[model samples]
Target chain A: MLSKKVILYFILITGGIITLAPFVWMLSASFMYDGHANVYPPRFIPDIFTLTQYEVLFQRLDIGKNFINSLFLSITVTAVSLFFNSMAGFAFAKYRFKGKNKLFNLLLSSMIIPAQVTMLPLFLMLKSVGLINTYMAVIIPGMANIFGIFLIRQYVLSIPDSLIESAKIDGASDFRIYRSIILPLAMPILVTLAIFTFMGTWNDFLWPLIALTDNSMYTMPVALANLMGEHSKDPELMMAGSVVTIIPVIIVFLALQKYYIKGIMMGSVKG
Target chain B: MRIRYSAPYLFLTPALTAIFVFFFIPVIAAFVISFTDFDIYAINNFGTARFIGFDNYKALINDQLFWTSLKNTFYFVIAAGPLSIAISLGAAILLSSKLVRLKPLFRLTYFLPVVTTLVAVAIVWRFIYHPRFGILNYFLEFFGINPIDWLGDPNWAMPAIILMAVWKNFGYNMIIFIAGLQNIPEDLYEAATIDGANGWQKFKKITLPMLAPTTLFISIITMIGFFQLFAEPYVMTQGGPLNSTLSIVQYMYQEGFRWWNMGYSAAIAFVLFLIIFTGTLIQFKLQKSPEA
Candidate 1:
């Protein structure tokens, strides 16, 4: 029995180490000098840590601009989508409307259509409207997602109808009820959805790479990919760029992990 | 009275409009564009695009690179999908075990890669797979193995990406599996234990059957996600060393965005959609057949 316990812990700990080693190496390599990361025996610890690579990234490469771009886009998209999705979710949950169930079923079924199928024409559609390479190009596509709406709707459905009815009895306006009652009540799911949206928008690559043509418009992932194109030989510098790109999402995930994990579990619950 | 009726429509208008314009329209437009010859000239002048029925799909049938990417993508999905699911289930079992302590810490560590930006992690793995100076090779030397050029070798590249993908993704399904495991009634396990069942026996009998629905869900989602393999091969190999790591999406991206073969790319995207749709249907059918 004791031996079995030991074996279980051993496997778990070893798995943890293997999982963490690359991140540890990436962090360590980012602090090393150029070519230092390429040395024989592949140092997991920098012999002498310096901030030159980060300095190069921020000062020379001006990745901070891309950082700001990612920040603005992620926050804008998250905030807007949260509002839009919650309103839609509230309607789906509480209100009785003509064709509501059919409309929702249509939306739910269409989730099977991959986003890649829409990318080609979406780009052209945006370009035709002179929105290409703009922040709107990223934000517009992300403004409302079916999954976000579904998540919010699921959460909203659990709220008692008495509260909304009482609010209606008190002469609360429809928008007022949503803002005051539903939004506040749905705070937990909203935070969860917010984290998902923020992390998703921040880490997105292909769409941003396609939509944003100019370097200045690049999100962190797209910027990191661009950096890799020109600086594949410079692992240390690329690692620094990566560290910059990944840190925000990590911080966000770690901070609200309880909600994030719960969100995944909530999402995976078979309809 | 008027406002009462309009409120739901008011609430849904913004989201529904955005979805319709951006998502639904584009999907329909992509299908239409797939039937035409839309390229760089078409981008400049919409009239330059010609209606070419089934030409793009036919051309894809003849294209060597398309077949290579399709093969590579299938290879990745087949290998990585099962591997990741197995690891996820294993990890879920271990973490959910009563014997394991500090489960949250272990869970967090494993899940770190899932939350990190894929492009960043892929780049990090690219360096880690460095032939000579990489820690992977350095560690392998202790086992008396020679250094292999992981990303640079056609034979090794897909496997390398598969390893990284499995590492990156397993934690996600592990969380879901944990949730699924939690939903199983503890009395069934107790009944099995009282029946003189061993650990593996209990698992094979009670756990596997109970977890079937969760397994089905995980498999379908994992397969769908895996079918869209891109950023990893894009950043790590550029589908390199003889295009061994090339994926269908990467091919679509190259053809549509890079080469402006928009019609052909749309066809590729549709093919991917059809593949995922069919794959999902098959999983659903397979899952149902046992019960029937």
Candidate 2:
């Protein structure tokens, strides 16, 4: 019995260490001297811990600009997308539109169509409108995602019809009810959706890679990828760039994990 | 007078309008554009683009690179999908067992990878797989194993990506699997224990059968996500080491954006869509067949 228990602990701890090793290495290597990361035994400890890598990243490489660019894009997209998706979701959940079910089913069925299908034409459309290389290209698509709307609608369904009906009887305007009642009641899922959208937008790479051409306009992942092309030799600097790109999303996920995990359970309820 | 009837529409207008323009319209336009000879010249002069019906699809049949990427993508999905699913189920079962302590810590540590930026982690894994100095090769030497060129070697390139992907993704489905496990009634296990059934037998009969639906859901979603393998290969390898890691989506991106082969790219996207649809349908069919 003791032997069996020992095996389980050994397996779990070993697996856990393997899973976390890269992240630990990323932080450690990011602070190492320029070529020190490329040494024998793959130094887990920094012999000369210096801020030189970050110095080069921020001062010479101007990664701080890319950091701000990613920050701005993620926040703007999250705020706008949450508003648009929730309004539509509330309508879908509470109101009696002429073709609500049909419209929703149409949207749901088309979710299987890969986002790549829209990339070509959307790129052309944005190019034609001179929106290419601008933040608008990312914002336009991010403003309304089907999954976000679906998630919000699913959550709003549980917020009783009676509550909404009473609010209506009290002469609250539709928008007023949505603002005063629905928003507060639906805060849990909203935070969940917000995290999903924020992380998604912040971590987004491909669309921004295509949409924003110049280095100044590039988001962090795109900027990091761009840096990889020019500085493949500088592993420490590249690791620092990665740490900068990844920290914000990790912080967000850590802080609001309850809602995030709850959101997953809600999603799996349908499954 | 008729304000109530219009309010819902009003609420939906902005969102629906955005979806229509940015999503639905673009889908239709991609289909239409797939039938035309759209390239760099077409980008500069839209008027010069001519309708070349089915040419892109025809060209795909003859394109070696297209076939190579399709095979590579399928290889990735087929290999990584099952591997990740197994790992997720194993981790879930172990964490959910009565003997486990500090389950929350295990789960949070496991799930950290899921929320991190893919490009960042991919970059991190790239270094971790570095031939001469990577921790992966470093760890292997303790067991009398030779240092393998993980990313540079064609034979190991896709497998390296697969290993990193499984590590990154298993935590997600592990959460779902844990949820599924919690839902399985404890009475059944107790009842089986009274009947003198062994642990392996209980698992084979009760656990696996009960978790079939969750497994199906996990499998389908995992397969769909895996089919769109781009960023890993893009960042880690750029589909290099003799294109062993070239994925279908990455190939499409190269064709459409890099070379301006919009029609060809659109055709590739549709084929991918068709593959996913059929794959999903097949999963449903397989899941249902057992019950029937």
Candidate 3:
């Protein structure tokens, strides 16, 4: 019985190591010189560390520009999407209107339609509008989404309808009720949605890859993918690029993890 | 009397417009494009465009690459879908047990990968699966096992992708399962125990029956997510090892953007939609039936 307990402990420790080792190696490899990472005896610790890979990335590859681009795009998309989704969600939750439930249901049911189904046509439409290589191409599609609306609607519905009714009796304008009342009460869900939108925009690869043909307009993930295409052999440089792309997202997720996790549970179970 | 109601639609206008333009319109346009020959040349000059009817989809039926992608997608979904659910269910049960201390710590640790950026994780796994110098091979060596070519071998590539996906995704379903488990009445388990049921018997007879709705929900969502396998192959394998890990979305991206076969790509996208939609319908039916 004691031996079995020890064995279980061993398994858990190993499992934890297995789960985390890749990230450890990624950090280690990022600090190594170019050819040092692929050595036969796989060094877990860098013998000699240098910031040259990062220098190469910023100076030669101009990944800093892509970093700024990704940052700008993600922040813009998150802010805009939060504002748009909240307004609609608040309306659905508090207001009585013809076809409101039906419209909401339509949106909810169509969530199963994978985003890829629309990518081709979306690209063409954006191209026709001459917005293909612009950030608008990415931001417009992400401006509002069914999931975001559904999430906010679910949370907002839990707010007593009487609150909105009282506000209306107090002669608050519709927009005023939304801006002042709904926004504050919905702050938690808003932050949660903000995290989701931010992470999603930060990690988005395919649409950006498709939409932004210009190197000048590339997001971090898109740029990293492109960098990998050209610099497949440069493990250290690629690791630095991957680190730059990932760290912001990780920090954001960790910072708002409580709301993020709650959002996931609410979204998944309710969904 | 309901002039007050105009405000809701007014407030809804921006979001509805965005969704209609960006989402619904594009979906309808994709269907239309799938029926036409909208290539790069046609993009340059719409006058040159030809309406190809179902030829693009018919061509897909004959195209070997399309079939390969379809098979690869199915391979991923079939291999990973059940494996993820099982692992999640098991972990949920273990974590929910009174025997487990520090449940939040364990849950957070397990759930960490689910929230991390996929591209970053995929990059890490690429290094971890490095043929010569990976930690995976080092550990396998300790067991006197041969180093497996995780991403490079054609046979192992999809399986490798599936394994990584299961690891990344199981935590999500685990949370749902834990919630489901918590909602199950304690008296049911107590009643089963008093009736002389063993742990396994109690689980099979009581817990499984009670968790049916949650399980159905998880399965359908998992199926939908697994069907859209893109970034894992894109980042880890680039749909390589002779395209063994090429997923439907990856193929669509390549066909549409890489080769400039927009119409043909739309056809592939519709096919993916068809598969996912049918899978969802079947899951709903199964849930409605007496199998529970």
Candidate 4:
């Protein structure tokens, strides 16, 4: 029995190390000076730990601009999406209307249509309206997603209708009921959705790669990729850039992981 | 009464309108544009583009690169999908075991890659797969295996990407599987143990059957997501080493954005949609009939 327990720990620990090694390597290599990461029998730690790689990334590469771009876009998308999805979700949950079921079902089924199908025409449409190469190009499509609305609606459904009815009887307006009752009750799911949205926008590569044509407007991922194109020889610098790109989302995930994990479980409950 | 009647629509108006204009319309427009010879010229003036039905699809059929990308995408989905799901299930089972301690810490460590920026990690793995200085090759040398040019060899490029993808994604499905495992009533396991069933028998008789629905859901979503492989190969090899790792979405991006062959790109997009839709339907059908 003792041997079995030892074997289990051994397996778990081994798996954990394999899973974390790349990240550990990345963090270690980021602090090495130029050409230092390329030596044979790769050094796991810097010979003389330095901040030169990070200094180059921020000062020479001006990745700070891209960092701001990513942060701005992620926060903007998350806040706007939360508002729009919650409003739509509240309507779907509490209200009676013509074709509500039909419309909701249509929206649900449309989720299967991959976003790639719309990218070409969406680009064209945005280009025609002269919205290309702007923040709006990213924010517009992300303003409200079907999944966000569905998640919000599922959580909002559990809020007792009696509260809304009581609020209504007290001559509170419809908007008032939504603002006071639904919003407060749905806070947990909202936080969950917020984390998902924030991470998604921060980590997004494709759309930003397409829409943000200028280098200055590039998000962290796109900037990192662009830097990679020109600086593949500089592993230390690239690793530093990578570290900068990933740290915020990791911190966000670790800080709010309970909500994030709950969100995933809630989303998988077959809606 | 008037205000009450209008309230839902008022609340829904912003979201519904955004979806209608940005999402629904673009989807329809993409379908329409796929039937036309839309290109850079079409971007300048819509009237210059000519309607050419099925030509794009025919072109795709004849296009060697498109076929290569389709094959590569299927290869990725078929290979990586099952491998990731299996690892996820194994990890889920281990974590859920009563003997485990520090379950949350272990889970967070494993799930770290899932939440990181994909482009950044792909770059990190690109270096990690380095032939001479890479930690992977350095570790493998202890087992008497020679260093491998992981991203430089046609035979190994796809496998490298698959390994990285599996590492990055398994934690997601692991979380879902843990939820599924927890949902199984404790009494089911209690009854099996009381019957003098061994561990393997209990798992086969109780766990597998109970986890069917969750497995089905995981498999379908994982397949869909895997079929859309782009960033790893894009950042790692640019679909190189003889294009062994080019994905369908990458191909679409090349034609649509890089080359501005919008019509052909839209056609490829539709094919992807059809494949995913068919895959989902087939899974649903398969899952339904087995129980009956």
Candidate 5:
């Protein structure tokens, strides 16, 4: 029994280190002076913790612009998507309409079609509209997603009809009921969907890479990829750039992980 | 004027309209474009696009890069997908065990990688796989192994990407597996014990059968996700060291976006979609067959 316990702890500790080492090394090396990282024994701790790497990233690389771009894109997409999707979801849940189920099923079935298939023509369409390299390019396609609507609809369905019926009996308008009753009741799912959308948009790379031609308009991931092309040799500075790009996501995940995990479970159980 | 029938449509009009205009239209356009020869010349002027039927498909057949990318993608999915599932399941079982303490801490630690940005982690891993100054080679020296060029060597580049992918993804499925494990009734274990079943026998006969549905779900989702391998090699190795790590998606991206070979790229996307769809269908059939 003792041997088994020892073996379990051994395994857990070793696996934990393996999972976390890259992040630890990244944070540690990011503060190391330039070229101070490329030595034998691979410094896990810097001799001197300097902010020069970040200074270079902000001052020279201008990653701050990309940072703001990522922030703006993530927040805007999340807010806009949540409002639109929740409205559609509320309609699906509470109201009866002709061809509603059929339309919803069609959207659900099409989820299997990978996003890449639509990306090519979408790029062309956006190009024709003169929206390339604009925030609208990223925000427009993201404004409505099938998964977000599905998630909100599932949550909205669980709310008892009596509550809405009471609100209706009070002579509240349909729009007023949705705005006051539904929005507050659906807060948890909205938070989950918002986190999911933000994380998805924040971590997104390929589409943003294709759509945003101008460097100034690039999001963090796109900017980081560009940095890799031009600055592959600068390990410390690259680590700093990575840290800048990843910190917000890590903050968001750590803060609201319960909702995020709940979202995943909800998505899998139904989907 | 109370609860008018048009309310639902009014509520849904904005979202439905956006999805229809943006998503549905683009998908059909891609299929149509795939049947034509749309390239840089066509992009310059829409009228220049030619209706060249089946030529892109024929060209893909002859294209060495497409074949290489497909082979590499298969190599990654086949190698990485099962390994990830096994690791995730193993971790889930251990964490679910009553003997384990600080389960939440362990679970959170394992799951941290799942939420981090893939590009950032890939960059961090690139440094970790450094030939001369890497922690991996440093640790390997204790066993008298020489430094290995992980990202630089074609032989090791894909393996390096696979290792990083497994690290990044296993935590996700681990959470799902934990949920599945919790759903299993504890009485079954007691019943198995009363029958004098040993640990391995209980696992084989009881746990395996009960977890089949969850396993099937995990396998399908993981396979579908793994088939879209792009950013790892794109960031870490650039599918380099003789294009050993080049993926189907990456090839499509390069052809469609980089070179503006929209028609050919669309064909690649459709092929990937078909592969994923067929894979999902096979999983569903396999899962149902055991019951029947």
Candidate 6:
């Protein structure tokens, strides 16, 4: 019985360590000096730690500029998308309209058509509008995703129609009722959706890679990927860049994890 | 109850407009462009585009790179998809056990990989899979096994990426599985115990049947997600080692972005959509038939 218990514990702990080792090693190697990380037997911990790689990243490679670009893009995307998605979501959930069910189902069915299908022509369309290499190229496409609208609509459905009706009876305007009543009531889910949007935009890779051709406008993931091409030999430097790319997401995840997890459950059950 | 029609339309305008311009417009545009011989020349002047109806799709049927990518993507989905589901089921079963303690800790540990940024983790795994100096090779030496070139070798590259992907993703399905497990009544297990059934019998007779719906859901979602295999290959291998790890999306990116063969790339994207659409429909049909 003791042996069985020990075996179970062993399996669980080993699995945990395997899941975590890459992240641990990434953090460790980020502090290692040049050529210090490429030892024959990989070092789990840096024997002589240094901040030079981070210095090189921020000062020489100018990752700070890219970092700011990523932050600005994520914040802008999150803020704008949340507003757009919530407005549409609330309308879909609460208001009566023609072809509502048809439109909603159409959008839902289209979810299976992966976003990659749109890339080629989307790029050309953005180029035609002279939006390529600008923040708008990234922001415009992500402004109101179907999934975001779906999530927000699900949350808004639980909201009582009486509240909106009462506000209407009180002579409140549509925008006024949305702002004063619906927005306040839906704050929790809005916060949850905000985290989702922010993390998604911050960590987005492929779209940003295709859209943002200019290095000056590159997000952190795109920049890190490009950096990997030139600095493949410099593991320490690459680790530092990875750290920069991942830290914001980790921080945001830690802060509002409940919402993130809840969002996953919501998506799973509904989807 | 007397809501104005225009109010709802006004509320939906921003999202609908954004979706139309960015999503629907591009989709229709991609279909249109796929019929043309659009290439780098078309980028400079739209007049350079010639109507070459179905030629791009025809070309794809013979393109070696397209076949390689489709094969690679299939290799990834088939190998990784079931392995991921199996691991998640195993972990979920173990954690769902009455014998287990510290459940939340175990759950959180398993789930850490799922929530972490994939691009960042891919970079970390790239180093971990390094042939000469990676920890993976060092660990293999202890078991008297020779260090195999994980990413560097053509034969091993796709498998290596698959392994890393399974590890990164299994946690997500585990969470879903745990929820499914919790939804199963304790009464069924109790009845199995009363019949003198051992653990394996109890799990086989009771748990498996109860979890069928959840299993189906997991499979479809996992299947959908795996079809979008892009970042792992992009970061770790750059679809390297004889292009063995090159996925469909990566191939599309190469055609569209790298070579600027927009028409050809658009055709590849449409093919992916067709595949995913068919797969999704099949899964739903199977799900419906089971109930019927």
What proportion of the real contacts between chains A and B does each prediction keep?
A: 0.92, 0.80, 0.63, 0.85, 0.72, 0.74
TM-scores of the candidates are 0.99, 0.98, 0.96, 0.99, 0.98, 0.96
lDDT of 2 by residue, B1-292 (tens): 2358878888899899999999999999999988988999999778888899999999999999999999999999999999999999999999998888999899999999999999999999999999999999999999989999999999999999999999999999999999999999999999999999999999998999999989888888899899999999999999988999999999999999999989889999999999999999999899999662
The numbered model that scores best in DockQ is 1
Candidate 3's docking class is medium
| Each model's Cα RMSD | 1.2, 1.4, 1.9, 1.2, 1.4, 1.8
Model 5 lDDT tens row, A42-146? 888998999999999999878899999999999999999998999999999999889988999998999888999999999999998899999999999999999
- Over 4 Å off in model 3, which ranges? A1-11, B1-3
lDDT of 2 at A242: 92
Interface RMSD of each: 0.6, 0.9, 1.6, 0.7, 0.9, 1.4
For residues B19-66, what per-residue lDDT tens digits would candidate 4 score against the true structure?
999899999999999999999988899998899989999999999999
- Candidate 3 local accuracy as lDDT? 0.86
Alpha-carbon deviation at A136 in model 4, angstroms: 0.6
Worst 10 residues of 4 chain B by lDDT: B1-10
DockQ category of candidate 6: medium
TM-score of chain A of 3: 0.96
Better of 3 and 5 by lDDT: 5
Clashing pairs in 4: none
Off by more than 4 A, model 2? B1-3
List-wise, what DockQ does each model earn?
A: 0.91, 0.84, 0.65, 0.89, 0.81, 0.74
Clashes of 3: 0
Q: What is the TM-score of chain A alone in each candidate?
A: 0.99, 0.97, 0.96, 0.98, 0.98, 0.96
Local distance difference test, per candidate? 0.94, 0.92, 0.86, 0.93, 0.92, 0.89
Chain B TM-score for the candidates in order: 0.98, 0.97, 0.97, 0.97, 0.96, 0.94
Worst 10-residue lDDT window for candidate 5 chain A reads: A262-271
Model 1 chain B poorest ten-residue lDDT run: B1-10
* Candidate 2 similarity to native, TM-score: 0.98
lDDT of 1 by residue, B33-106 (tens): 99999999999899999999999999999999999999999999999999999999999999999988899999
